[model samples]
Target: DQQVKQNSPSLSVQEGRISILNCDYTNSMFDYFLWYKKYPAEGPTFLISISSIKDKNEDGRFTVFLNKSAKHLSLHIVPSQPGDSAVYFCAAPYNNNDMRFGAGTRLTVKP
Candidate 1:
């Protein structure tokens, strides 16, 4: 069974609009939540992250919110741009040395 899940396979938004991606997790031991953005051929690069102790974290146009009680988290992009279009993954460290990732959500930002 997958510990992390992304129910939405894909999402689309007009440029300069807002984009929201959702993620859920079953494990409570995960204290660190992270978001990664991946282009076609390149590996995923870190976007933003939040500690389980905090409810929200933001960096520039990207923000991550964690709801521990609901076992849910979401990534929000404000004024989404075309360059932001990519497959986004939610992840948390597992086994203290590795990570567990959600299925990923492909975001399309159209001009």
Candidate 2:
């Protein structure tokens, strides 16, 4: 069974608009939730994270919200820029050792 999943495979928005990405996971042991952005042929770069103890975390234009009761999480980007177009992934540490990632969501910011 897949521990993490992104129901929406892709999303598009006009520049300067808000974009929301959703993620769900089956594992409850996951304590550290993170978002990463990736470009083709390059490794993912960490964007933001929220600890299980908190409901929300924000950095610049990016924010992450966690609903532990529902085993769901979301990433919100405000006033998204064209450069923000990329594959965004939700990840968490698995068994306190390896990291597990969801099937990424591709966000397209139209000019």
Candidate 3:
């Protein structure tokens, strides 16, 4: 079974607005959450990450929020720019060598 899911396959937002990408997981053992952004021909790059012990983590224009009780996490990008357009994936690590990822959501930021 798929442990993590991104219900929306795509999202669109205007420049300077907020873009929200959501993810849900079924496994309760996951203690770390990570977000990755991928371009068409490049490998996914780590965007942000959060620990289960924290509800929110922010780095400049990007922020990751976690709700352990709901097994949900979201990535928020403020002042969304055209350069930020990419596919976003949410992931959870069950162990050092094992990680589960959500089918990414493609985000489009229009100028």
Off by over 4 Å in 1: none
lDDT of 1 by residue, 1-111 (tens): 899999999999999999999999999999999999999999999999999889999999998999999999999999899999999999999877899999999999999
lDDT of 2 by residue, 41-91 (tens): 999998999999999998999989999999999999998999999999999
Q: Estimate each model's TM-score.
A: 0.97, 0.97, 0.98
- Decreasing lDDT order of the candidates: 3, 1, 2
What are the lDDT figures for the candidates, one per model? 0.95, 0.94, 0.96
Candidate 3 lDDT for residue 16: 97
Could you give the candidate ranking by TM-score, starting with the highest? 3, 1, 2
- Every model's Cα RMSD, please? 0.6, 0.7, 0.6
Which of 1 and 2 is the better model by TM-score?
Answer: 1
